[model samples]
Target: MNLDEKMLLLATCFLFLPYQIASVGIACILVQAFCRHKLVDAIKNQTGAIFLYSFIGLEFIVTILHSNWTGLGNTWLFVLVGLYGAYYRKSITKNTFEKMCDLVIILSIFAAIYGLYQFNQISIANGRTFLEFHIFNSPKRRITSTFMNANIYAMVIDFVCVMCMYRFVKNDNILCKIGYVIVALFNFFVLYLTGSRTALLPFVLIFPIFLYCVRWKKLFITSIVLELCVCGLVFLKPSLIPRMSDMSTFASRIKIWKTAFICISMYPLFGWGPQTYKKFYP
Candidate 1:
């Protein structure tokens, strides 16, 4: 197989491994940066690109809660990419980077569709399980779709939907706009199926941000009021309360985060020397 084919196989394998998709994406960015120095320089020159590279740190921080070899590799990849970009700057076209992003979006859509199929139990062997894509397994048959867990599936689709919406907004094509809406609805439905409280927060936050940024103040206020009314209705319906309570991982995550924080505090400057969270995490 060619080098490109080998890399694709490795990426596919990693998708099934116990690592996060976001981490895998960071790794891909690192590989791209090293192999294409011109692309790295272009990224460094772009303000938004710089922000994206900086944003990877937040992923690293959160992934520390479940630090493993994969987690370390992801973090190091992100760090190396940013450092390399900073050290080298040159004028270069961003067409390749944009093409790569388009490919990622296409793959993410497929992942979302696969996740939906998994929820429906329409999967074959030699095919990836939804749980593997999601990054963690859920208890009581969570319908993870193409992910290891429903939450990851929801998160990934949500981001994909957002990117699609961004692209749609920039184009005047009716078909593209319709496709974006369809994809967005599909992602929203999958997220609802996951019943993840954390997944819901982004919708609550981002919808308003988008409306306000687009200068739709009246519509924004109306949307907020409508949401409040819906919440009130749900609050009044006692049966809905139990369903609402079904969507929290706060306790479990708090426990994990606390353990990880303790490890970080203990090691402070150097951390537990990579892949040590499991050894020390409670």
Candidate 2:
């Protein structure tokens, strides 16, 4: 593999590590881009790059106007990472892309295992049964694994689950298919433990579309039966999915969305300066 590809793999590995180690991975990509003089080309070659930079520029102007300098760092970080993605997408070879996907699935399996362990530990510490443990009991109660939060962890797991499903349908190797199924099931359970209603809801809706697209009749029927069972379980014990059962959390999010809409209307261009949501949310 080339240096860029190797750095990309390194970044993927860093993604599952704790304590904002992913920033180091981002730094690696940025440094490699600088050394290779790929930064400008990365922006210029991509079709959407102009729009991305325009949005960033507008955000910067809004930040200056609002004097929300603290939010500027996040905007810059987002732009840098986005640029790296654009560059990598254009430059990555087919072999490298396949390798990256395989690496992501492998890492996701390990992450899911760690998250399950974290959940078990938390449940034991709380002296509650696994099913009885509420994710929102505290910030630390949810199975974050190596990511910053349960939602992020759930998002990654959701992506990996879809990848696994795709590979399972497409690959001819029996052993590889078995591995994919195992990983998908493991990660799906971990996703459930995450208590990320947003991620779970979308996955539920998208998985059927994937199965339909792949034209897997038997697997699709099996999936339907499994989903029916899951629905039955949820019906019996709504607390299994806390976010669905808890109306208060949903109401809180609704209020936040309403406030965000108001804030957007007030600004109408750019934004309330990145991380200023808390200031205006109330």
Highest lDDT: which candidate?
Answer: 2
Best by the TM-score measure: 2
Give lDDT tens digits, candidate 2, residues 1-282: 778788777777877887356776677677777778876676677877778888888888878888888788777777767777777776688777667778999999778888878988888888867676556534578899889899899898888888787777667999999999898888888887888887887766677778877887787777778888988998999877766766766677799899989888987866667788878873
What lDDT does each candidate get? 0.59, 0.79
Question: In model 1, which residue pairs have backbone atoms overlapping below 3 Å?
Answer: 115-145, 115-146, 130-146, 130-147, 131-147, 131-148, 134-147, 134-148
| Per-candidate count of clashing residue pairs (backbone under 3 Å) | 8, 0
**The CA-based lDDT of model 2 is what?**
0.79
- Total clashes, candidate 1? 8
- The sequence of per-residue lDDT tens digits that candidate 1 reaches over residues 211-262 is 7877789978987888788678877883342236443556777888998888
